[model samples]
Target chain A: MKLKIWLSLATISVFFVGNTAFANEAEETVTPDEELYDTSILIEETELALTEEQMERALLLDEFANDRLSEIEATIEEGNIEEAEQLIEQYEEYLERLESELEESEEEQEASEEETNEEDNEVERVELPDSDDNDENEQGEDSDEENQEESAEDQDKSEEELRESAKQRTIILQALLEREDLPEQAKAGIAKALENQKRAEENYLRAKTEKAVSDEDEDEQEQEKEEEETELQEEREEEAAEQVEEENDNEAVVKAEQKQNKAEKKQQKAEEKAEKKQQKAAEKAEKAERKAEEKIEKAEEKANKAKEKAQEKQKKAEEKAQEEQEKAEEKNEKKQAKKAQENRQKEEKKNGKPNHQ
Target chain B: MKRAMMITCLFLLCACGQGEDATNDDNNSGQTEAVLYENDVFQIEEIDGWSVDQEATAEQEQNVIFSNGTTRLIVSIVSKEQTIDTLKKDVQSSFSKKVELIEDDENYIALLTNRKENIRGDVYFHQGSEHQLIFTFMTPEQHYQESKNQINAFNEGITIF
Candidate 1:
């Protein structure tokens, strides 16, 4: 019996635990009306704060503004005019912020574009020092074209998106304003919100129109600049071509002059060589003639010497012959005298003694 | 029989505790804490009255920003090798020149005032093993002290992966 009582107590405890769990679960479920709108706004603000790009932020703001409008409509449908009025005020504030943001974004974009232009100009100045102005201008035009294409594509896409969103919001607001069952208290707030929306739309349209005009003006300016650049380029090309032609002509003249000078120098050298050859030949001939004359003179002198020697030999032989003849005659006369003296006997002895003496 | 009575009383006490917990949960119904962001390097959650800035988070690869009214909490994970000295230097350099070192410990904390902007920031540096986590809480100078709890709560919600 005690065990049975224990089991019954345990059962009762389990039932109490189960009941508590169910109660907690029921309390956890929350309805949309009970949802914290303030948190939603905080979330929206947080999202906006986090967005770094202006166009993206504008788009987010547009989305949030639409959310507010939907909330206002829901509140109005629920007969909560006070809440609807509050949302309408919030909506107006959102619209104001959106407008300011869009304006700020546009200004920032313009400022950034100006900064890019300045930077490009600086780059052109820095990079193209020795280059021709035409080349520099062409480079600048190329960079400008690239930047414009990129900026135009992005700006056009974003602007188109914003314009579409604005139009959609305007239509939604108008439809809401046209609701027949809207409470009198909510009607004024909605009308005021609608007016604010229209004003924002008008501002957007005006800005877009101005942007279009400005773009047209920029296109015209770019076209004119391009034309000027092309003309300058053409003139520069013509000048370069002319300079090349002149350089070629001057080079040809210099080459011809050089050729003539070379030919003259070659002819002069050949003439000098011919003159030297003639002078050498003349000198050789004169030396041969002088050698021949000296040989002739030497031969004549040799012949004269030979003749004089022969004459001297002949004279010497004659002188010798005369001496022999004289000697013979003397001998004969001495012999005859000796004979005659012998004939005279004693007179021959005396003649012989005189002869010995 | 006494044991059974004691067991029943214990169960009754547990039930009451659960009911009280449920009441507390009801009180904090819409203000539930949730994981606001997660990545390969870290995870962070939304604190009470603070919401995550999705755009700012998406803009930077490893950075997140949480905002509440005029106060903002910026959390960034730097995938760089860092020591205490470098972390201190980073903290000092990350803020304005007028930033003062308020607390120096394992985590470096700094207080910076931008007089021109009328803003004040309480910056904290947490050095991890392979990465450094920087948390910057900024608000108007007037509300700097009032936003301390939010800053602390945000700090508590950060988890480095």
Candidate 2:
């Protein structure tokens, strides 16, 4: 009886949670991509994604931006031509701000993506020395770093999504602007929308140039990591050689040590040669494969060209045949008509009807 | 090897020879076509199988009308006395709602109109320093497909010297 009561409680709680999920989804009036011009969800997502400073610039790009352009067009449609110029200029600033925001976000994303890419590079090059225990320890440490890095990557993905949303909005605005059959009054609004997009693009390029100067820091970090790895390996080699040197107490021992060092150097040279040969072989195979692919593509292109030429020739031949047949048919009809006219003339003469008539 | 090459050349020549014959036939078809009308005043060079109306009694009639059976070309000289807007308004009213203003500007305004009885006319209004000219070419819908190129050529051939 107690078990049954516990089961009933669990079932009731599950039903309540399911109902809550459905109710939450039903609250949204429009889903993404339902309407190209509708920006409800995208605006909400963007507002969430942007920081406090960025939010200020993003305000100009609100869904209410369409209202100002619509108002300008309404004024123009009312035949207020003189005020239209001033209205267009006033609306241009808001569009400029929105465009700059788009650009700023894009530039910031590019800079942040470069930094993440460098970190990924450093993580990739973190291969431990030839020791299993060291490798295992380093692997565990790398996994933890990777988990932390994943959150940073998640931030980048969100930034990318925001940029994509901005691009979609810009494209939709431009498409609405390109309607030629639209009235001149309505054109003012479309033009303003386009102007905003253009201003955004320009602002992005300007900002990208300034941000590009800072991208050198990520490159320097990558170089520093490579230097650190090389220094660490050199230190390990020196420590091993020092241990061997400390044991050299007599002449025979020193000579044995020198011989051992010479043998080791010879093995290292042979290993380097083997590695070079293997790399060259791989390169040669890749080159030959590429050449073979190119040759096949060239053969296919030649065959296609020849086929097209032959088809064109055949088409021309058929057209000529058709025209010749038409000409023969026309000539035959003309001859038959002439002959029938002669027969009618003979009959008319026999009946004594005047040929002149 | 030489014999094989000769055979291949012959085969290709035969394939393309039909095109040459068609081209020759096309040239012959046009060679038989003779000119019928040439006008200097309304700045027309030549027209095939068409003649200017030489029987109009009214001297004040500012129109030079060309005819080939049912098809007609009527050129009205405006003398820059009226604005292009007036001409636009006049055509709009004459053709009513279905008149499409294809090209509209200060120097040139062209209108295409489809009227009752399957008749369609292409009207061009050209502006010059001394005079404005309106040319209306009217044809039936059946004849339009064949005569469109001829009409375009006639319009292009007119020089206002």
Candidate 3:
């Protein structure tokens, strides 16, 4: 009863703490644009994740990724977006298969654990009176303890593997999120997957904590402890699921508010843009009007200057004509005078004597 | 008279030396004098009876080919971005045939093979500080012997800038 009470208290405390931790963990990155920037990053991470494959399988996967990338490029070149999308889906399926393989191996390990536990229970139930076979019984107990220790180590190792597997899933999720063109349902699907991983991480941590407690309290009835722990874990899982549902509701409400805020911001930005455009248009029209008035003023001034230039040219032409007439008159007068002198000379020659001018 | 005689002797000496030089050039005509061919990357001396086909140098991987009808030299200017081993793998895959490495040094590797009955391929790979150059020489089996000597001359004349 005391153990049950302590376990209950631990469960309650874990609930509150786990809720906060998971809520934080499950917090979705709000900026969709930032998610788009992660595509290349996720691809690089996929490459890094590939380094763990030190075998032929890893090489094959590397080759497969390269080949798929080539195929997708070719499909895109042919302008078949649908086919390219399908190819991407097929390639992602291969990645998902790795995750699923990990899950399946974990399940097989759990099954083996259950089998060992049942065998241990059977060994416990086998009633053998105190007899000469006590040595055999001790050996059996020793072997059982060894088995338990081995299973515990295996569980610890699998914990690390599980963490690794979850990390890989998270990487894939990041890649999925990076695809800005995915449908809303697809985004929701990724969200659900993230929630699942969070829950898995929580359970894993709880299991670790409980294992420590069990180790410390090993003097207690081990079988009853196991049964109680299982029940308590189940109960906690139920509570966690409900808590997740409630958190989802709260998240939705928060998202809706965020959406409304975004919409308001967008509308205000649009209004500001329109007002600025209108103001710019008014300024442009005013500038154009000023330019046109200036151009007309310049043209009119040019025309007036041209008229003045033409009048001056006409006056200059008249003056030139007058100068020519004056010169011609002087030449005519000179010719008449010369002709008169010649006439006088001719008269003298005809008389064959000097004549008075 | 003495000056005239000395001038005549000098003229005779000059004529005899010129005749001998001309005859020697004719006798050694088979040596095939080479001329330096260079562009932005590296310089190679192209030998006599060989010329680059400008039209066939349009491929992205290889930009130049020097040919003498029966024999050809393909030049690929690989950038310094890749390691030497990667360059070899690329060459092997590009040819789609196993190439035997005949010369391996810190700066270069020479790969050769007789791909066909009467045709041979020789690849001279040079790892440079700024560029990796690959020279693929293909020639008929009969000309392969002479082609090797010519290739060596070309290699010796090559100076990567």
Each model's C-alpha lDDT? 0.67, 0.57, 0.57
Each model's TM-score for chain A is 0.51, 0.35, 0.29
Error of 2 at A156 (Å): 4.5
Cα lDDT, model 1, residue A124: 58
Give the least accurate 10-residue stretch of model 3 chain B, judged by summed lDDT: B90-99
**Candidate 1 stretches greater than 4 Å from native:** A1-32, A129-152, A233-357, B1-161
Candidate 2 lDDT tens digits, B55-156: 531332556666664556666666566677665555433332234666666645555543222345566777655777777666655677776777776776
Q: What is the TM-score of chain A in candidate 3?
A: 0.29
The DockQ of each candidate is 0.02, 0.00, 0.01
Question: iRMS of each prediction in angstroms?
Answer: 14.9, 27.7, 18.9
Per-residue alpha-carbon lDDT of candidate 1 for residues A143-172, written as tens digits (9 for 90 to 100):
878878887688778778777876777667
Which pairs of residues collide in candidate 2?
A99-A200
Off by over 4 Å in 2: A1-51, A55-91, A99-196, A202-227, A249-357, B1-161
Residue range A82-142, candidate 2, lDDT tens digits? 5555555645655666656655656565676767568766855675567567777667768
Candidate 3 residue-wise lDDT, B1-161, digit = tens: 99999999999999999999999998677334444467777776666666776665543233566776566676777767767665554443232122366666654555453232233556667766777787766665566777777777667867776
Where's the lowest-lDDT run of ten residues in candidate 1 chain A? A29-38
Cα lDDT of model 3 by residue, A60-143, tens digit: 243344344445444555655665566566555544444444445445655666787687678667747676776887798798
Clashing pairs in 1: A50-B56
